[model samples]
Target: MTTNKLEQLKQMTVVVADTGDIDAIREFAPVDATTNPSLLFKAAQLPRYQSVVRGVVDWSKTQGGDINTQLINCSDRLAVDIGAEILKIIPGTISTEVDARASFDTQATLKKAYRLIELYEQSGISSDRILIKIASTWEGIRAAELLEREGIRCNLTLLFSLQQAMACADAGIYLISPFVGRILDWYKADTGRDHYPAAEDPGVVSVKEIFNYYKAHAYDTIVMGASFRNCEEIEQLAGCDRLTISPQLLEQLKQDNAPLIRKLDPARAEAATAKISLQENLFRWSLNENPMATEKLAEGIRNFAADQRKLETLLQQFWR
Candidate 1:
């Protein structure tokens, strides 16, 4: 409403907070918020959250609980505690992820998603107030489909390719978080190219193509670009459905040295004609055949899984 270049462009892109630092989230005022195991792990290790963890531990002692269960119970407690507070600042949803270790198991993923929703519900939040975050694997998509049918919205994370977006659309997910920085990382590593400008970076290219495809086909799945390296990259993606930017880049946008303009406009794509239908058989074949999607999906699941364990260990110590 300010008509400031950056603030005006924000009207087009659904800005999201890509961090666990609640103070940063408050300052930036991102519409929605997202957090994963890695971010949660980092947040827990910080001295500020020490009180929350200790409170959970004290509660566990009062209940005479199992150590492992109590520790994990503590993580669930913290995720909801922080998530609900963020929701107070922003009128949109919060993305609370399921354990990534269950990423490959459809049933386990569904079970974890249900548990996550129940945790939120217990915290006085409705299913509509939260999105169950899942990895964007075939298993994850299928699980998302099941959750969607049950009225649990999902935010598909670690998405890097068109194949993943197609599958997510097929699954009727609430949103898909395409990682811009990670995509940039892969392209830079594979192509051995440095010096990525805002408009031409491979990561920017990937999200742009996905955006054009989604708008062209009128796909209902909201594409939220994540993990950016610079404000230019974010500015270039102005027309995306949503973009989860870090506080560092958000702060950079507040300073005005150059003009900010919208790069993506839904009105411009009104003439597009392609549309898609969900086909599980086709989805499976596509995910199986795309080597990068296959490898990256597995690798992402593993990396998040590792972070989950590390956080669990830290929670164990907190319980002690």
Candidate 2:
């Protein structure tokens, strides 16, 4: 009997469900799950999560502040509540993101992260099961460094280039989510090409480089490939530490019985290489020089922040 690609992939890589749908989470039974503002915005509109939304709004109202303040509080609670629900299903950690608007503000990001963890604890969820997701901005990286010291693990997201990954490793971050699909999007738009072969795909290639570098250097930070365009991208990264995939692709993988091979191996990875230290100036300059990374990082933050506002607006309807 042949095993489905999904099962095979799970045997190697830690497959993470990248959605806010509880039903999908139950169906796929991923070991881990991740959610961002966009996913939470969509999940908030779902009927099953309506009660969760209402409960959070009700709680926020009792806290007492202006409507804006209440909305902010409610949104944070909703994200945590959804994450808590996800945690109940998965044995692994859930990556709940911080406000993208705070991406460039280290102090504000730290404050928000602390509050998020507190909310989780209030809900009886431990900090160990929560991965605070922050953007890969220099400020965000700085914020994560502080959080890690307090035993708060972070998922450094919106990453594109090696510089961001190196900076995260240097900061002792828990995990880094390299947006595989977005990198491919940039190259397609920039070169006016339709598609690239899976092995040669720019996104796949980028993750491979990051994976190899981290493994070769024996960095403790994990490399989780995120934001995939298709199963091919996931297949190309068969042995990644983790891959947070959307439900649609998860279903596709479940149906296909094709053999899956491990594409990345730490044991077979080349020997350790000389580590490069990335200070603020070099990190900023290198990111500035890489047009794709710079553009995608900014675009990702803007899109996430926009969805966050949208989520708040949706929650506002329950303010009555």
Candidate 3:
């Protein structure tokens, strides 16, 4: 019996479902699941999740705050509620993202992270099983450093460059989600190219570089490749620490029975890259220098913030 690509890929990498859809999560049965504002927004609009949305809104009514505050509270609660639902089906952890609007505010990010964990704890979910997802801004990374010291794991997201990865690792973050598809998007638009082979894909190259650097330096931070554009990108990153693939790509992998080759291996990875002593100024400057990383990082934050606001608007309807 020949194993499908999804099974073969999972043999080497921890496959994570990158969606807020519970049905898709049940179908893919990934070890872990991740949700962002965009995914949560999509899930919130689905008829199946109406009860979850209403429940959060109804619960928010009893919390006693103004409409705006209540909307924020409801959005956060809904994220955790969906995550809690996903947690029931998966044996591993779930990545619930912090509000992207707080990406630059260390204190705000920390507070929101604390509140999210508090909500999860209130739901009888341990902090150990939750990874507070935050953007890879310097402030966010600092916030994560403090949270990690207090036993709160973090997933530094929207990462597009090695500098971001190094900063997260230096902070002892639990994981970093380097956006592969977004990187490819940046390059295609910049260079005006339509397609690139999987092996030579800039996004694939970026993740491989980060993965190799982490493995070579023996950094404990896990590099999870995310935001894949196609199955080829996923196939190329066969042995990453983790890969959070969307359900569409997951289905494609499940249908394809082709041989899945492992392209990344820590044992065979050898890079002479020295450890980066990244301070705030240098980290910011490096990001400023890399146009693709800079643009994509800011764009990612804006997009997530927009979706968060959209989700808030959707929840407002239930407030009445």
Candidate 4:
């Protein structure tokens, strides 16, 4: 019997399920799980999660707040409720995202993160078992830095450039999720090329660069390659510290019996000569210089924020 690719990849990287489907998480048994407002919102519409949504709605009514406040409260409650359920299935931590609208506000992000931690604590879950997900914006990084100091860990998401990764590292966050598929999508659209081999793939290149940079600097922040488009992309980054893959690709990997090659080596990272330290102005300008990163970063945030609003609207349907 040949070794399955999923099993092979597991030997080198920590597998994380990037979905809100409880059954999918159970089937894959990933080491960790991550969810965003969009995923939670999708799950809320399913018949199995109707009770989860209604439970939050009912609880929100008992608390004092306006309709908008009630909606926000219900959304947050539902996120943690879903997270709590996911935690029961996965032994590791869950990455519950803060509200995307608060992405640019450091203080708001901090307050919301604190609230999320409190909710988890109230439910008898330890703070160690949760990772607050935040955008990779400067403000978001600042908020994460503050939270990390107080013993709360965070996963910086929507990262598209080295500058973003470096900022997150400077903040000393627990993890950084550099999006791969999104970067590929941007390059494909811009260049009119639909096919890219793993070696030539812009997305794969971006992750490898970030991974090597992190290892070279000896930064403690874990590099998690996210938003994968295919199994080839996943296989190419076989030795990454972590890979949060969609269940679709995971299933694809399970079906393939092939030898997985470890493409990245920490030893090679020591040879990297490009090092950067950024001030506020330099960071902004550096990001601006990379048109792909700048556009994708903004687009990623806008899409997530839009999905968040959509999630809010879904909760409002049950308010009456």
Writing each residue's lDDT as its tens digit, candidate 4 over 122-178 gives 889999999999998889999999999999999999999988888888878899999
Task: Say which prediction, candidate 3 or candidate 4, comes out ahead on TM-score.
Answer: 3
Clashing pairs in 1: 239-264
Q: Looking at model 2, which ten-residue stretch has the lowest summed lDDT?
A: 266-275
Question: How much is the lDDT of residue 52 in candidate 3?
Answer: 93
RMSD of each: 2.4, 1.0, 0.7, 1.1
lDDT per residue (tens digit) for residues 1-320 in model 1: 34454576577888888888878888878888998888888988877778876776676566556777776677777777778777888889999988887887899999888877877788788999899999987888999999999888999998877878888887788899988887777777778888787788877888888888887777888989888988778888997899998788888887654666788876675423255554767766776886666666778888988988898788788644
User: Which ranges of candidate 3 are over 4 A from the true structure?
Assistant: none
Off by over 4 Å in 4: 270-273
Assess the local accuracy of residue 74 in candidate 4 as a C-alpha lDDT between 0 and 100.
85
Residue lDDT tens for model 2, 121-164: 99999999999999999999999999999999999999999889
- In order of appearance, the predictions have TM-scores of 0.91, 0.98, 0.99, 0.98
Clashing pairs in 3: none
Residue 112 in candidate 1, Cα distance off native in Å: 1.2
Mark the regions of model 2 whose C-alpha exceeds 4 Å error after superposition: 271-274
Give the true-structure RMSD of model 4: 1.1
